[model samples]
Each structure stands twice: as C-alpha cells, then as structure tokens.
Target: MPTILMRYRAAALLGAAVIIAPLSVAAFSAHNVAAAAPTLSASPNTGGSFAPIVSADKPAVVTVTTVIKAENAGDEEASPFRGNSPFDEQFRQFFQDQGIPMPDQSPEPRQGQRAEALGSGFVVSADGYIVTNNHVIDKASGITVTLDDGTQLPAKLVGADPKNDLAVLKIKPSKPLATVGWGDSDALRVGDQVLAIGNPFGIGTTVTSGIVSARGRDLNSGPYDDFIQIDAPINHGNSGGPLVDAQGKVVGIDTAIYSPNGGSVGVGFAIPSDQARKVVATLMKDGSIEHGFIGVQIQPVTADIADAIGLGQPEGALVAGVNGGTPAAKAGLKAGDVINAFGGSPVKSPRDLSRMVADLSPGTSKSLSVWRTGQSRDVPITIGRNTGDQQ
Candidate 1:
C-alpha cells in the first residue's frame, strides 16, 4: 500500500481545475485576536503563513496496519462442482462430451483464504486519541499504528459507530503526540480549497490539494450522511485522515471516493469536522453515542400527496408509519400527519427530521408541530436511543 495521499485527477491535470467559490469567513475569524508586542531582544517567531493546510498536520498522520486471521479450512464447505455453481454444469458437460468419468465430491472441507488490509488515521488529541473509519478496522483482530518517525504502537478500540462509518482509537504513546486542530466545517463552502493528508497504498505521508466540490452531500453512509464532497485524490489507504483547510485546521475526515476502477476519480467524500468531532466527543466521554429517535418513518410530502391531503402546497415530512408504542405514536401521531417542526428546528424533509433527532440528547423530551386534518398542533415526544434494533 502506498502511504502518500493520491492526487486529484482534475486538479492535477492543470486544465480541469474548477473555480474556487467565495466563502463566508467572517464567522470563522471571529475569535482571532491580536498578539501583544514582545518586550525585548528578538521578535517572536510567528507561524509562517501558508496556503495549503497539510504542512503541519502531516506529523499527526499515521499508517494503520491490520492483520486478519482466517480459518485454514471449513468443516463442510460447498463444492464448486455441485448445485448452482457455474462450474457444476461445465464439469458435467465436460465429462459427457469427452467421454470421461466424473469424480465424486469429497466429504472434506476446502481450505480458506486470508487477506490483509491497510488504511490511515490521524491524531486528534495529544493524549493518544485517534480517529479513523470503522470499515478500516472492521473484523480486524489486531491493529498497529505506525508514526512518521517509524514508531509503532498498539491501538485499542475506544468505540465505533458503524452507522456513520467512524471509529475512535486510543494508543498508549510513551511520548507527547502531535494533534491537529479542528476547523469549522460548517463554515466551508463549495469550491473552497482544501488539502488532504494521509498514507495511500502504504506510502509515506502524502499531501494533495483540491477544492470542495460540494457540501452537505449525502453518500448514503447513514441517515446523517452530510458529507463534504471534494475533488481531492483519495485512495484505499486514505480513509480516516484529516481533510485540512488553508489554515491548517482539520475540516473533514477523508472517507470514500466515487470510483469504478478502484482509483481516484476526482470525487472523494469526507465526514465534516463538525459532525466528526461530535462523534469523537461522545465516544471519548461515554464510550458510545446515544442517538435520538422520533419513532416515525416520514417522507417529504410531494405534490400528489399534498393534493390528496387537501394541502395547498407540499412541505414537511409526511408520517408514513408510526411505531406502535413509540413516543410519536403515544403522542397521538398518525400516518399522514405532516411534521413541520422538531423541537424548535424547522422540519423541511425526512433528512431534516432525522438530523434533528440524531443531534438531540436521548431521553430528552422534544416538542413537535404537525399538520393534521387541516389543523396544526404540538406534540411532545421523548427521544430514545437507536439501540441498533429500531429505525
């Protein structure tokens, strides 16, 4: 595996680079303060200004190596010569055509195959906290993190959220660690320049630059799939590394790419820093995140459904089904009820409601405003943990 970050195809070509969209940076710079003048001998060394942000973050990036132990053989593995296997009919036809006898299936099982994979991660805290993609460590019995200095450490799983494809890790580093500063991902706009740093294909730490192609993108990672789409070069080993902005702050975590040839396609996906930080915090503090549930399967009311319901315009999430004893059902919520408000946040669509519920604290009661039977009313529902058993 290469450890360097892959280069974006479009941006690297020098001709296909997209326009950089102007972003609102006022809010992001609101906390900037002027430093007091130094009293004596020499001027303090101010951090050098830079355009790409991955300059200082490279040290915090690490290469993750995983070992998979597989069984050598199965007790009773299915034979390729039997049943619906393509080789079954071919074997039978071959014997019939060539006038040769076919061998009987053996009772013994076949041998198994083992595979090893590599990925990347970034340090988020100096105390040995790291973040990476859950899929990178999935089913991995052993994991090792290799720093830039050739130092290797055994990492333990702090917590993992498969729904969002994220995992938290803790390494027992004997020395102080370098960590990346978090950025305001919400402040990033489409076309903003970004830098991606990671170990791609087991290569040493590599840095690639590109622009944010889009924001609030949904790659079906989960209900809260608001990702930042970038035209950065991201490959197999880039998963879980930081997507830094121009200020050397981590704005996102590189996760996936839209590719058919198993290579960079100039379209990479990353989890926003805002959302990732929340997951990291929950994993660090409570070892798990407690998701809020509204207990209703809602769909955005379309024109047809709105007309059928006699509503003048289509809006809000239409309750398609309600859990029998869930909080929504207990609050008199029924199918066809249009949810317009969750707590005080506007509910524009199913995704909106899903985000609202997920961001709320579990067991906390929230107010919902719904339109039903030509009337709007408020209903209270106590949010519940997802528990992985319910929608």
Candidate 2:
C-alpha cells in the first residue's frame, strides 16, 4: 500500500483500539484476583472536544433551510448509458457493431422538499447578524432561524454578494447572540491544525478535526478566490459553518467539499475569514459591494514574453488591453506593459492584480510600478469603479 494510506489505516486502528479497550477492562476485572482495571482517561479528548465547542457555539450555528418555488418535478434523471469496462475499450469495433447510445441529457433537479434544504450558519455580530453561503438562503422567500436551544425566529436578508458566495442575514433574538471571533486566515499555513463544527446531514452540531491541506486555492469560485483548504469532513449541510483553529477562533467558513460519492474524500474548501470580513462589512454598510478596477486587461507573463520585455524572470501581469479614457490609459499605461507591483505589493499574476485592485477603494489613488524596456517606472493612477461583470 502507499505510505499515506498505510499511515491513515494505522491511525484508524489506533483510534478504534483506544475507544474499545476500556470496554474490555470490566471483563478482565471479573477474574478472581480483582486487580484494578485499566481506567479510561477522564480529561478532555479530541473527538469529544466537539461536544464542548458545539455546546458553546451551537447557539450561533443556526440550521438554515431554503425554500424555493420551481416548476420541474425535481428528481435528477438517471443516465441510461454505461461506461466501457477496463478491457471493453480495446474492443470498441466489436461493440460498435451493436447499437449504443451516449448519455446526453441535462440532469433534472431533485424534487421533494420545496420547503427546506438543510444547511448551517454562524452569527458574526451581537445584533443577531449571521453569515452563510449565498446558496443556503438564496431565493428563500421566508427564512426562519432555528437556534440550537430550539428557538425559531424570523430572519430578514440583510444583503447578499453572489460573487463571494456569501450572504448576511438579520434576526432579532431575544437576547444578545453568541458570536465567534474571526482569526487571521493569512497566518494559517498548510499542515496547521484546524477544526470544523457544524450540523451535517441534519444531525445535531457535530465537530471534525483535521489540518490545513492547502491555502489560497482558486477553485474558480470568484474573482477574489482565496480559499483555505482543509482535510476536515465538511458535508452537505456543513456549508457556512465556522472552520475554527485550536483556539476556537474562526479562520475560515466551511464552504465546499470535493466528493464524487457525496462523502468526504478529505478535500474541502473554505472562504478565508479575512475576505469574508471585508465582504460582510461592505454588505452590512452599503447593501452592495463596489470593487476597484485599474482598467487594464492582463495576462500572465510567459518566459518568452518576459525575455522579450527585458524582464530577468517571468513574473508579474502582462497588460493586454487598457480601457479607453480610464485612469490607467491616462497614466500612460499602454498595452504590453508588465505590471510588477501595485501600492508596493508584488503582482504575481493576473489574478493577483485583480484581487489587489478589487480590494482597493474606488476613486482612490494607488501607485503602480511596471517594468518596460529594461526599465522600471512607478505611475500613480486614480482607481475607477468596475462597472463590467465582476467575478
């Protein structure tokens, strides 16, 4: 077996042994000698740590169910075609003699609960403000927030930004709501320990532990694509719950998991709390987000292009087009100029520049340093509103 698989199996065996050993102690203690039985540790453990954290955060982790009206009877249609076996593809000519149809229809949506699809959410503020995935509550006509203690309250949509896949909801709880502190997601490194606490598969609050598998993973979810990837088991209903560190401070929101069988294969993605914080704040204050733009369409500088442009190495964004009459054009930033830095921050690629520009304030002036003709020049340009389709 592979080394990683062997290690996983060994760890699983160890966990099972630890939990089952205590039960056999009484059986052995029944002997005539009546020796003291091996006692289980009474102190807190990792698996059981979920209980304490869940108990404390349950009030903030609300069960979110979405209701949407649809016309189609929603069950997904089954595919009528079958894949060729391992050796079947080798004999395609023989099989082609027989008629076979390829699977080619769009899947039908599932039909059943038009009333609700279970998910999770977390309170971000004391004023009964909550943050959840845009999908969890999208197209929901009447949202009801069900507390951990069984209190159901009406909730209103504060604002939603589909680009980030996040939404803010408001509810008037009877008392101050429990809120989790946001941790510095930028400080998280791959292999750092992490925890995921949420309601999974409609089960009560459950917790799972794992480590940061990756960082800044771009799943093509949005323009500001910076996801903190974790190995924690985040299931269907786990979306929108907090991915906290060992300190119980939330570093990311449990957003997505990659599964072919609808079960965790140890791959999961979360929106970094730092980005979510900015989105949530903007949604709360302005009811909509306005991102900054530099009016430059850019591409990644390749080795050949870098050499042609007199760059020592291939790094930074290659400008492809500049919007007419925009700040970048007015600042003499022409096509083919490689932007190396913005506001003293290095621009690694097109996405890096896109994110940095989006995070900037519209109408604010920012400096751009570019490399051209074996020379570097810094140009100041006033940021402009991004009116085009945003990611």
Q: Residue 321's C-alpha lDDT in candidate 2?
A: 89
Tens digits of per-residue lDDT for model 1 on 1-391? 2222232221112111111100011111212212222111112123644423444667778876555444311221112222222123544564457665444432332234333445678766665767787766666667788887778889998887766667777798877676666778999999887888776655567788889999887543347778788998886567777787777777888876644344576877788888777777777666776777768887778999889877777878999999988878778899989988888888777888888887777789989988899888898888877766344
lDDT of 2 by residue, 1-391 (tens): 1432243233222210000000000011111212222221122235646555545545567766454443211321111111211112322332244443222222333444233444578766655677787656655666666676667778888887766767777788767666666677889999988778776655566678999999987644336777787898876567678887665667888876644444577877788887787777777666777778877778889999987878987989998988788878888998889998999999888888888888776888989999877899998988888776331
CA lDDT, every model vs. true structure: 0.65, 0.63
Which regions of candidate 2 are displaced past 4 Å? Answer: 1-52, 71-115, 323-327, 388-391
Give candidate 1's root-mean-square deviation (CA, Å).
12.6
Please, what is the TM-score per model? Answer: 0.75, 0.74
Clashes of each: 10, 4
TM-score of 2: 0.74
